[model samples]
Each structure stands twice: as C-alpha cells, then as structure tokens.
Target: MIVFDKVTKHYGSHKALDDVSFSIRPREFVILVGPSGAGKTTLIKLLLCEEKPTFGRITIDDKDIHLLKDRYIPYYRRQIGVVFQDFKLLPNQTVAENVAFAMEVSGKPDNEITKEVMKILELVGLKDKASNFPRELSGGEIQRVAIARALVFQPKFLIADEPTGNLDPVTAWDITKLLLKINSLGTTVLLATHNREIVDNINKRVINMDKGRVVRDRRRGKYDYK
Candidate 1:
C-alpha cells in the first residue's frame, strides 16, 4: 500500500503540494487529472524520493521512504517504475539494447540482461523491433521502449507522467490500453494525464488536483471535476 498523509511541499515560497492525502492500494489503476501546475509531477517526485515533502509522511509498503539512507534510495527506487512524457531513449541504442541498458547499469549478468530484455520487450509488444533503433521506430514504439526500460526492475508501482502527451489520439489510446494490460498483470499504475478524452474513457479511479491540492477523488470516475 502507498499512503500520503497530509503531504506538503515548499519550493521557496511557492507551495507545490498543500496538505495532500491519499492512499493507493496494490494493483490499482489510478488516473491523476489536472490542469497546468496542479502538482501532479510533484507528487510523483515525492513518491520517487527525488524530493522530500516539507511535512507529512509518504510510506510505501510501510516504509517511510524519505527517511531511507542515501545508499538505500537507489534500491528503494527500484521498486517503482517511472515513465515520462519525453520517451527518453538513446538514439544510438537498439530497442533491446535500450531496455538492456537499465539492467547493464545495475550490474546484471549478460545472460540475465538478455533474457529479461527480451521478456519485457515482448510484454510491450516490441519484441520484433528489438534490433530497431529509437530513430527508426514510431513515436508509440519509442514510448514502448521507454516503458520496457522502466520495467526492467519489475517494479511494483508504475508511474506514467504524461506518457501519451506525445502521441496522437489513436496512438495515445493504444498506449493507454497497453498500460491497462500492464495493470491487469498486477502492477499498480498511476497515470498523470491532461487528455480529457482518455481520462473520461478510462473509467478508473480519478484524482483531480488544482492549485497543489486534491479537488476531487472518485472511484470508477471520469474527468468531470469542476
């Protein structure tokens, strides 16, 4: 379980998050909706332990992540996978190599890296593009490589911040479906998106934020918050 208890973050005098509280259960698919500067990215950053909250506690699986030692931060982060709007793939690396790079950096064995890279690529429907470079793939396929790279750790939580921001509607929905499939496989998904069509169409738990505060949270909901 992931719990955010009265979380608040301050950037100089600007509050990025204000007294936010929520809980995410394991294997749950949650959509985060908001306009610009709604604090969505800040929330993800807190979860990733990239930034510490000025107040409140963020506990994942019962551990207060902020209190973890610096040496342990890397290991703690391995438990969660993150994908961003910009599909950060090396232009020079092949799809398989891009995915394998994550493991390679972690000192994974050559055999294990090869095996897991193929497995995750297949899961993302990009196994056949293993030899293709990012420059050769479509926008959606490039995003798939990013997702595959993020999953190399087999993270329990997957935070997708604007994963569809770079795709057309049809392709965006396709990626959404892929995320849904991944959630069905038991990884908790937290998607932060601005696309109303996709958000309303999803019919999942929606957490709407504005001015750094949660304005609405609904179960089996849409982007209808006002």
Candidate 2:
C-alpha cells in the first residue's frame, strides 16, 4: 500500500536519504533497523509529508503524496498514525481526554468520539487509567497512552519511531507484542527502532538502512546486520 520510488532527501549539502526505495504491502509488519543517522527519521518525515524529497516520489495507494495539497494533508494523515520516541501527551489533559482530543479535532460527533475513546482505551489496556494524568503513569503506561491515541482513529498504517526507546527490555517486549497484535488485526506496522533484541525477537520483515540506503531486507529473520 506504500511505495517509495528512488526517494532521495537532502538537507542543504548533506544527503539524508539516497535513492531509498521500498514498498510495504497491506497488513505487512515491517521493521526499519539501522544505527544512528541512518535516515530512518527522514524516511518517516517524507511519509508524513513533513518534508519533501529532494528527488523521486512517494506514493500511497497510487497517489503521489508530494502532489497533494497542504490543506488535504491532515485528511490523508487520518489513514496513517504516528507514535514518537517521546510520548507527546498533553500534560494537563486526562488520559481519556488526550485520546478523545484527536477525534474532537476531526469534528467527529460527540457520541462517536466518546465511543471511540472508550474503545481505544480498552484496546490499549488503559481503561482504568482514563482519568489519570500523564504524570501519574509509568513510562510504559505513558507509551501505551500514546499508542492508544495513535490507534484511536482506526488508521490503516501505524508508524512508530523508536516506540520503546526509553523502556526496560521487558516493557519493550510488551510494546512490541502489542504492535504485533495490531499488525495481526490488519493494520500495517512500520517500526523504526535500534533495539537489537526486540527486532531479532520479532522475526518479521526487517529493512536495514545505512547512509541513506537500504542495506538489507529480510523476512522472518534475525537482527545480525551491522
């Protein structure tokens, strides 16, 4: 459902991505693995339309993303969800409110918003923390809240950038298991992470990028790439 055609990205004189090309089919769980400065974040920024490619094209469902109008970008993003390394939660908003905020901003009906927020909370195993603030939750719980918010819209594609960055190995596995579950339920998962153990344990599709190029692509493989 997603394709990158010889995509290249540059910042001033430095190249961040160099002719990177790949396609991710529907319901496929793909992991982007590489060391620092490997252009993983740049790839995501291009997908989110936060940055334009210096060359080549990015297409989603056959539509060229760069050609899309700015005003329609948000609408397009509704089909995709993004979770960052840092949980970008509203410190003052309750957990329920934070998840509900996305639907509310989209102009969804009040009843629909309520139902979706509740369902997503349950999906992320955070129903009991509905009224709690971010400060009251552990790192793992906070990441779960972020995942809940990302999944609230029932997005077709979920892109998580270092989702388990700050968690313990055990908690990281919990998060990866959740991502796998989401993938099994038909959402495409693209995880960008450097956690070797988690990536190896996943045994899913791994795309290793280095110096702006995809150095390795494997299906159901271990993380032995350097």
Candidate 3:
C-alpha cells in the first residue's frame, strides 16, 4: 500500500503540492488526472524520491520512503518502475538488450537477465521485436520496449507519466491496453495523463488535481473539470 500523509512541497514561495493526501491499495490501478502543472509531476517525483516533501511523510507498504539513505535509494527505487513520455531507450541497443540493461545495472546474473528479459518482452507483446533497435520500431513499439524494461525487475508499483503522449490515437490506446494488462498481472499502476478519452474509457479510479490540490477522487470516475 502507498500512503501520502498531508504531503506538501514548496519551491521558494510557490506551492507545488499542498497538504495532499491519498492512499493506493495493492494491485489498484489509479489514474492521476490533471492539466499541466496541477502538481501531478510533483506528486510522482515525491513518490520516486526525486524530491522530498517539505512537510509530510510518504510510506509504501509501511516503510517511509523519504527516510531512506542516499545509498539505499537505488534499491528502494528498484521496487517501483517508472515509464516516461519519452520512452527512454538506448538508440544503439536492441529491445532485448534495453530490457536486460535494467537487471544488469542491478548486478543480476546474465542467465537470469536473459530469462527475465524474454519473459517481460513476451508480456509486453514485443517478443518478435526483441532483436530490433529503438530507431527501427514504431512509436508504440518503442513504448512497449520502455514498459518491458521497467517491468524487468518485477516492480511492485508501476508509474507511467504520459506513456502514450507521443503516439497516434490508435497506437495510444494500444499502449493503454498494455498498461491495463500489466495492472491485471498484479502490479499496482499509477498513470498520470491528461487524455480525457483514455481516462473516461478506462473508468478506473480517478484522482483529479488542480492548483496543487485533489478536487475529486472516485471509483469508475470520468474525466471532468469544474
């Protein structure tokens, strides 16, 4: 479970997040929907420990993430996978290599890396493109590689920040379906997106934010701004 207790973040005199609090149960798929600068990115950064809250605590599975020492941060981060809008894949590496690199960096054995990489590639429906480079794949395929890489470690939580922002409508929905599939496999997902169509279509738990505050949160919620 992930819990945010009265979380607040400030940048000099400006407030990025203000007394925001929410909890995500295990295996829950939650969408964090908001316009740009609605504190969505700040919230993700706090969860990822990229930035610390000025005045609150964030705990995952009863462990406070903000208290982790610098040296232990990497290990903690490994438990949460993050996918970005850019599909950060190495242009020179094959899809398989890109996914394997995550495990390799964590010092996993080569045999285990190969096995896990193949499994994740198949999970993301990119098994046929394992040998292909990022430049050779379509936008959707590249995002699949990104997701596969994020899942290589079998993270307990998956946070996708605009994973489909760069794809066409058809391809975007394809990526969305893949995320839903990942969630179905038991990885808790926190998707931050501005796409109302996808949010309304998915009809999952929605947390709507504006001006650094959560205005509404509901199950089977549609995208609405008031």
Candidate 4:
C-alpha cells in the first residue's frame, strides 16, 4: 500500500499541496484528475521521492521512502515505473535497443538485457518493431516504446502522466486500454490525466483535486461531481 499522510508542500510562500492525504492499495488502478496547478504533479514528485514533503510522510509497503538512505534511493526507485506525456525515446536507437539501454545502464548482463527487452517489447505489443527506429513508428507506437522501457525492471507501481495527451482520441483510447491491460496484469497504475472521456469511461477509483486539496474521491467515479 502507498499512503500519503497529511502531506504538504510549499514553495517559498506559495503552497503547492495542502494537507493532502490518500492511500492507494496494491494492484489498484486509480485516476487523478484536476485542472492545472492543482498539485497533481507535486504529489507525484513527492511519491517518486524526487521532492521531500514539508510536513508529513509517505509510506510504501510500511516503509517511509523519504527516510531511505541516498544510496538506497536508486534501489527504491527501481521498483516504480513512470511514463510521461512526451515519448522520450532515443532517435538513434531501435526499439529493442532503447528498452535494452535502460537495463544496460543499470549494469544488467548483455544476455539478460536481450532476453528481458524482447519480453517487455512483446508485452507492449511492439516485438515486431523491435528492430525499427523511433522515426519509423507512429505516435502511439512511440509511446508504447516508452512504456516498454519503463517496464524493463518489472516495477510494482506504473505511474503515467498524461500518457494519452498527444494521441488522437482513437489512439488515446488504445493507449488507455493498454494501461488497463497492464493494470489487469497486477501492476498498480496511477494515471494522472484530465481527459474527461477516458476518465468517464474507465469507471475506476477517481481522486479529484482542486487548489492543492483533494475535493472528492469516488469508486467507479466520473469526471465531475455532476
């Protein structure tokens, strides 16, 4: 479980997150929706241990991640996977090489890198394109490559930030479905998006934020209170 207890974040005199609290259970698919500057990104940064909370603690599986030593932070981060709106793929590297690069940088053996890269590329439905460069794939396929890269470590938590923002509706839904499929496969998914269509259709747990606070939360929720 991931718990945020009375979390608060302040930048100078402006507060980015205000006394927010929430808990995400294991294997849960949760949508976080809010307008800009509602603290969604701030909260994610805290959860990823990229920033420290001004007051309060975040615990994962009963462990306080902020308390983890600097040397252990890398190990801790390996358990969490994050995908972003921009597909950050290397233009020069092929799909397989892009995914394999993640493991290689972490010191995995060449044999294991080859094996796991194929396994994840297959999982993201990109095995056939493994030899193709990023320029050869579509927007959705580029995003798939990014996702495959994130999955290389078999992370327990898969957090996506506006993953479908750049795609067409049809393609966006395809990516959304892909996320749903990943969640069904037992990975906890925290999707931060303001796309009303996708949010209304998913019908999963929704946490609504406004002005740095959680205004409402509902199971099988819609995009708005109305």
lDDT of each: 0.92, 0.92, 0.92, 0.91
Give lDDT tens digits, candidate 4, residues 97-176.
98998788789999999999999998889989999999999999999999898889888899998898899999899889
Question: lDDT for model 1, on a 0 to 1 scale?
Answer: 0.92
Prediction 2 global C-alpha lDDT: 0.92
Which residue pairs in candidate 2 collide? none
Model 3 lowest lDDT segment of ten: 217-226
In TM-score terms, candidate 4 sits at 0.95
Query: What tens-digit string does per-residue lDDT give for candidate 2 at 28-92?
Result: 99999888899999999999999999999999999999999999999888778889899899999
**If the candidates were sorted by their TM-score against the true structure, best first, what order would they fall in?**
2, 3, 1, 4
Residue 224 lDDT, candidate 1, scale 0-100:
72
- Per-residue lDDT for 1-226 in model 3, tens only? 9999999999999899999999999999999998888999999999989999999899998989999999998888888898999998988999999999889989999998998998888888899999988999999999989999889889989999989889899999999999999899999999999888999999899999998998899988888963
Top-TM-score candidate index: 2
The TM-score of predicted model 3 comes to: 0.97
In candidate 3, stretches whose alpha carbon ends up further than 4 angstroms from where it belongs are none
